[model samples]
Target: IMEYKRGSTLRRGQWTAFVFLLMIVHQCVGDIRYSITEEIKRGSVVGRFSQDLGIDVKTLSTRRPRIEFEGNTRYCDINQKTGDLIVNERMDREELCGQRPSCALLFDFFLENPLELHRVTLEIQDVNDNFPTFPNEVIKLEISESAIKGERFSIDEALDTDTGVNSVQGYTLSANEHFTLSVHTSADTGKYAEIVLEHELDREKQDELSLILTAYDGGKPQKSGTVVIQVRVLDANDNVPVFTQSIYKVSVPENATLGTAVVTVSASDADEGANGELTYEFSHISIKTKNTFSLDPKSGEIKIKTMIDFEDTSSFELRVKAKDGAGQAASCKVIVDVADINDNAPVILIKSLKSPLPENSPAGTEVALIYVQDRDSESNSKVRCSIEQNTYFKLSPSIKKHISLITAVELDRETQSEYNITLIATDEGYPPLSSFQTITLIVSDVNDNQPVFDEQSYSAYVTENNKPGSSLCYVTARDRDWRQNGTVVYSLLASDVDGDPLKNLFLLDSKTGVINLAGPIDYEEQPIYELRVLAKDGAGLVSYTKVLIDITDVNDNAPVILIKTLTNPIPENVAPRALWPWR
Candidate 1:
């Protein structure tokens, strides 16, 4: 066992010395193998790590071994005291192990008190669940007249190579006279059978007797052995009590109440009165049949003992024996089959469904496919699928137990972007069971709408000598399309007489469509300005609108008279009404 001392990390020199010492010690103790079970659920015990490592429990108590993965992921844990390794997470051979012949996880074992790294391989054993079988179909037993009553005989028992629940667990012998059956339990707890004589026999009347012994195990659908054994009464018994019939087959509803009478089996003796009188008792009963049925100790009647379920166990094979006061007995086989009843609702499975489907899909476009499952017996699992009252979608027949969700009408993303549809599945059972499933369908965006302007034209007024960058007016456009199709951007398309761009005269916010004065306004120069603005969307769709700004006039400018002089560019005139101009 590897010991990991938990404390401050040691220095490089000390670690190197520790490693050297460990290498010397490891050469003496060879590696060990640990066996574990594959497919074991999480939180289950895999193996005792310390025990498999040949470490004593007391030594393991001081140092706890921790299983560490590459990323320090904990898929299993180790018990400090017992050193047992238990699964902490789920493991899949095909996923983690893949197609490799063997899958193994190598982990570093850190021990507290003394630190050490030990490599261990856990071998996961596969589960054994094969059915049991007998090499021979029949066995012959010879009994002589000298054979005494109450004597037991030995016969070959069934053989099963598999282990665990897959191995033979018990035996069942069909009812017969002259011989009673007994099971021999092995040290491993597996069961085999032997034949015993119930009473003395006389050879004159009966020559041969026959019986069936079945060997069964515990597994899905169960596995078992079947064999025929013939006993040569080379001698016979006093007309062994005989049953009214050798075999009886019957059926009962699974809902049959406990203690309800199922079948009455009877046997008679040749001798009269008490000698002819007989009693009944069950033999070679199975675990499944024992819980479900009970037999009358006196009347040879069988009744329900517990709830009957066809799904769990369908039928029972029982042995009923009747013996006279003289000890002469006879037995018969009874097989009671449970009938199925409809009492469960259908289960729904969604196979193909797309979340957030694009809007405006074709009428026949598929939205989803629903599959229905039912547990009831035939004529019951058959189901019909339908969509709730929806104008946009409908359910169409696809295959058995499957229905396709198809669009019935053209969808408009603008009207409704998403839709939740309810699907109902109903079975053909009485008081039919039904189930509902809800799915959401989303409609995606498309560039189909043109930007809209708040108004075709907007009006505003500004005073002469108005400050620059003053808000004059606003123009807005809207589109109903989603995403990039609906967004609107504003731009200037006209300018003032100065031959400058309109953007220079007025600032327009592309997002809000607000227009601000870029330059001062003058009533004397320009009384009014007509601005054409364009709004465009990310989809390249555009719309145009206009803004009219009226500049109010103010009498602030005084009258001026200019006269050109002969020698200079500027001239002064003497008269106020007449002006002299120089070339």
Candidate 2:
């Protein structure tokens, strides 16, 4: 008698309950593990379950060795007479084991008669179904512009699930002029590759390049995956600079100020690094042109160096050059046109004069002094002068551009004390320039006027800390004489302050009539200072005024205590009556 337990439900054709019957005297057989290609038909042979398990064919045929999948599906069954385990259902390895290299199907088996317990494992072998693939759709690489030939860059390998002849076998890169593909076998038997430089990289010509890399397997009709290879080239010094234009044109005013911009030129370079930087300068220079124009090295700007004169030269030709850090250069021509502007004016400068003539002087006496000049170019600045028509005065040329207004007839000073004559100047130009100035003639008067000071005495006080050349006081004088005869000048007379010259201690502004401190003052040296100042008319008539300067004290000196005397040898001998030194 034997007791049995159900192994679970094992279906045959439809569905059947699996029961395990144990014969008290029966032995358990070793489990069988067999491999077979997937996608097999229902009648495919798995293995000889009877012989491999030590069971006889007669016993296996009668008892019937059964294999049921865990999900109640019968995948293999023994022949009822031959004891051969055969496939009972379609087996797809991809669905059964996916991409796993080691995959097996475990099922329960139950036999009758004496009853027995055993297990079987069916391993599904994989076939080529999936293609090789890359983890990324594109591979990015950066190459230096200075890269030399034969330089290699390692790239990631492609991945494939299938093993043996079905896995990645090789790698190939698309054809290019600068690079080639080098393939190597990785330690894991995977195909690895590197990009080798066939030629040096030049970013100036081409900064970026694109290519393709294909990973392929040895399957029939070969399956492969492609990844885009993108390469970016970095910069290096390789090219020279080039100007945008061969020539440039500019116009500027003839009287343009120094540093006036004439034109700006721009250039470009194809190479990077130091080769791309550009600088500008005058390529062709002439003495006359160089004196009048200059260029900025960094900005490529041409500027006026000296004042230009349209009448002297209306047009100029310049050649400019541009250079790069690599010392390569290019040049262009610059045509500069100087436009005329109204800048020059006729000038009248006094040369000689004899005004304030005697009342009863005869005619033909030179009375006015003058000279004329124009600052335009030689052709435009040829100036001439003439005195306006008048009854008592006439214009007469004396020397080069020099003229005098002379008396036309005898004159009487009492009847008319003065005469105003106009001297006119003219230049030669398109619109000719002219200017006029008035000259005054006065009748003579005797030396009957003298200058008198507005104040007989001036007093001022300055602090000890006052800076040198500080204004202390103002004392002006007046004269009744007319014109130059009435002009009065003030001066400081020789004087002594603490035995020092007064001029050393004070100074006066001759025309403004201002007295200023000439040196630092000290209240301790001299508290008060007084001196006589003189006023003189143009005719040598003089008068005098007194100036007084009081110096105030400031806390600029530190206090000091002095010791008159102290006994040296009598100290240690007798000290009964002690005495302190007087200070």
Measured by lDDT, the strongest candidate is 2
**Please, what are the lDDT tens digits per residue for candidate 1 over residues 242-351?**
78898889999888888899999988778665556787766545445666788887888899999987755566777776766544556688988888676656666665
Per-residue lDDT of candidate 2, residues 1-583 (tens digit)? 1112233222212111111232122234445567887777898788776666667888777774555444546778767677777888877765564344566776655564443445566777766677877756876665668867886765556766665677788998888899898998844335777788998988889989999999998877688989998887864445556788887888897878888888898899897766677888664334467678888899888889898887556778776767676445666778898876545667776544567787667797767545565656554666666668778887665432245567888776546779888877777656777888988888785445688888889899989868888989989899876667678998888888658898888998887789998988899888898878888888899899988888889888899988677656455766777874543
Q: Number of the top candidate by TM-score?
A: 1
TM-score, cand. 1: 0.58
**Please, what's the RMSD in Å of model 2?**
50.4
Shift of residue 149 alpha carbon in model 1, Å = 12
Q: Model 2: clashing residue pairs?
A: 352-369
Each prediction's RMSD over C-alphas, in Å, is 18.6, 50.4
Report the C-alpha displacement of residue 148, candidate 1, in angstroms.
Answer: 8.3
| Candidate 1 segments exceeding 4 Å error | 1-237, 271-285, 311-331, 398-400, 440-450, 481-487, 493-497, 537-541, 556-583
Poorest stretch of ten by lDDT in candidate 2: 11-20
